[model samples]
Target chain A: MKPSSPLGARFRTAVLTLSLAVVATLGSVSRADVPVREEPQRPSAFGATEDAPLPTVAPGDLQGLLRNCDAERERAVAAQKLCEQDKTGVDFLGAAYAALWIILMAFFALVAIRQRRLSAELATLRERLARLGER
Target chain B: MSASSPDADLQPARPGVTWMPYVVAAALLVALFLVFFVAPRERTMGEVQRIFYFHVASAFAALIGWVGCAVASLAYLFLSARQGMEVIAKITDRLAHALGEIGVLFGTIVLITGPLWAKPVWKTYWTWEPRLVLMMLTQFLFIGYLVLRAYAKKDVAGRKLAAGIAVIGGPAVYLIHVAVELWGGNHPQVVSGQGGGLQHPDMQLTFAVAIASVLLFAASLVHLRMRHHAFTDELEDAYLELSDREDARS
Candidate 1:
C-alpha cells in the first residue's frame, strides 16, 4: 500500500509494532528455560495437566516438569496482578484530573461573571457622572 | 480591560470581550465529540475504554505546552529580544499553565478509567509499576511548574529566576521515566524498558490516530492562548495607565 495516507502509515506502523511485541514475548519464554540446574530439568507443576500446551521439548523427569509448569503459572498470575495494580493507580489519577477541570472551569466562569458585573457597574457610574456634568 | 497583575489573583479567567475563549470552548467541544463518538472504541478495552481519548489527548496537550515552554525560554535566553521573547514567554507560560491544568484533569481520568479498563482483565486497582509511577511524576512536575510560576512575581529578577528553573525543569520532567525504569512494576518500559506496547495492530493504529488528533487540538489551543496573552497584556497596561491618573487626582 502507498504510504501517502495517514491511515496506511498508521496501519503499517501498528502491524510492525504488534508483530515485534509478539516476537519479544515469545522470545522471552523460549530463551528463559536456561539450564540453570546442572542436571537436566523437567516440566513445571503445571505439567500435571495433560492438556497443557508448552514447548515440544521431549518430556523430562516428572518432578522437574511439574516444577517448571508451576513456575510458569505463577509468573502468569504475577503479571496479571501487576496489571491490575497499575490500572487502579491510573483510575485514581483520572478522577483527580476530572475534578481539577470542573474546579477550573467553574472558577473561570465565576471570574468572568464577576468582572462583567463590575464593568457594567462602572459603566453605570460613568453615565451618572456624565449627566451631572451636562447639568 | 483587565488590569489584574500577572500574579494578582491566581484566578482562572476574568471577563473579557474576545473570540478566542469561545474558540477554545468550541474546539474543546468538538474534540469531545470527535473523540467519544467519532473515534472507534478500542478493540481491547471496549466502551469503557473510550475515556482514553480525552485522557491521553490532554496529556499530549501538556506535552505540547512543555515543549513550547522550553523553546520560548531558550529564545528568551539566546536572543534577548526583550519584547518578542518576553511576549512569547508570557504566552507560553499561560499555555503551560492551561495545559498543566488540563493534564492534571486528564491524568486523573487515565488513572480512574485505567482500573475500570484493567479490572475486567486484571481485577485490581492501583499498582507500583513504572508506567503509572512515571505518569504520576509527570503530573506532579507540571503542578510544581504552575505553582512556581504563580509564586514567582513578574519582574526582571522573577523572569530570570523562572527562566533558570524552566531550563532545569524542562528536561528534568522527563526523568520520571528513568526513575520508573529503576523499579519494578508492570509498565511496559521499552522506550524507557518494559515492553510498553501490547503489539496489537489495531490497537497501535488507534492509539497513534488518537494521539495525533489530540495534538492538533492542543496546537490550535496554544495558538489562541498565545494571542490572548498579548492582548491581555496590552489591556492590563492600559488599565495601569488609567489607574495612575486616578492616583494623581486623589
Candidate 2:
C-alpha cells in the first residue's frame, strides 16, 4: 500500500479519521461535549463598503472597467471562499462514507470470525448428505 | 490435461516437474520487479503510484473471472435443457463458482489497495466520481453472486436463479468502462489528474504487463480448479462404474 497520499487526501483522511476517533474515544472517556468555538459571520459582499479606483482612468474603456472593478473583485473573492467551502464539504462526505464502511466492516469481521467454525461443521454435514444421496 | 495421471501429475506444489503455479509465481515476481524497478516513479505521486500495478492488475483479473462466470452461467442454462449431460456441465458449473470467488477475492484487493493508493494521490479515501461508484456496485453484485452460490441447492431451480443473475454480469462489465469515461468527462481535474487522455504510454505498458501476468495467473487458477473438479468427478465415475459391474454380476 502506498503510504503517503497527496495533500488533499491527507487533509480529508486526517480530518475524518481524527474526527471519528475523537468522537468515539472522547465520548467513551468523558461525558462532556467539547465546546466548539464559532467564528463571527462576515457580512456578505453586498453589504461591504464600496472601494473606489485610483485617479488614473482615461476616457476610453478604462473608465467603465474601473467603475465596476470593486464590485467584481468582491464577487470573485466571495466565489473563491465558496469554492474552498465546497471542496471541504466534498471531502467531508467522502471521508465519512469510506470511514463508516471500513470501521463497520472491520467490526463485523472481527465479530463474525468467531462463529466461522460452527458454519464449517454445518457445511461438513451437508457434504456428507450429498455423498449419501449418491449411494 | 496431459497423458499423465492427474492424481499424480496435477496437484499444486507437487515434487519434480510441476510448472503451473511456479510459472504463475514467476510472472508475479517479474510484474512486481518491472513495476518497482523499471517504471519511472510518478513525478506527482512518487512511490505510492507503485500500488497502481497490483490495483489495476487485480481489476483486470477480476474482469476475466467475471467473464468466465458469465460464459459458464450461459452455457449451464443451455445445457440444463438436455438429458444425459456429460462432465462438461458439472465442470463448467464448478468453474463458474471458482471464477466468481476469485473475482471477488481480487476485487477485494483492488478496493482495499485502491483507498490506500488514492489516499496518497487524491488525499481522500473516495469521491463521488462515477468510476468509484460503479466499482462499488460491481463489487456488490459479485458479493450477491457469492451469496447466491452459497445458498443455492444443487437442484434445477437453484441453478436457474444463479444463472439469471449471472446474465447481468456482462452488461455490468461494459457499464464500468463507460462509467469511468463519463465520470472523467464530468470531473476533469480530480484523482489521478494525469493527462495523456488517461492512457499514458508508460502507464499503458505497465497496465498491459499487469493484464498479461494477471491472465497467466487466472489461467493457472482455472486450470487448477478444473483439475480438482475433474478429479473429483473421476472418483464419482469410478464408484458408479463399480456399482454397474456389481449390478451386472447380481
Please tell me which predicted candidate would have the highest lDDT against the true structure: 2
Count of steric clashes across candidates, in order:
33, 4
Q: Against the hidden reference, what TM-scores do the models get?
A: 0.51, 0.55
List CA RMSD, all candidates.
17.2, 16.1
Question: Per-residue lDDT of A1-135 in model 2, one digit per residue for the tens?
Answer: 877434334335544654575477447646654333233221111111123354555668766677667667875786566455444444543443354347436633743552354345335534543554466
DockQ score of the complex predicted as candidate 1: 0.03
lDDT of 1 by residue, B156-233 (tens): 444444455455546644654355446645432322323344243444444556566556545554554444444444
lDDT of 2 by residue, B53-155 (tens): 6666777877778877888888877777678674567767778876876677666766676666555345555555676666666776766665665555344
What's model 1's TM-score?
A: 0.51
Chain A TM-score for each candidate, in the given order?
0.42, 0.34
Deviation in angstroms for A87 in model 1?
A: 16
Give the Å error, residue B176, model 1: 3.5
**lDDT (Cα, 0-100) at B171 in candidate 1:** 66
Q: Rate the local accuracy (lDDT) of all candidates.
A: 0.49, 0.57
Could you tell me the lDDT of residue B47 within candidate 2?
52
Docking model 2 quality class? incorrect
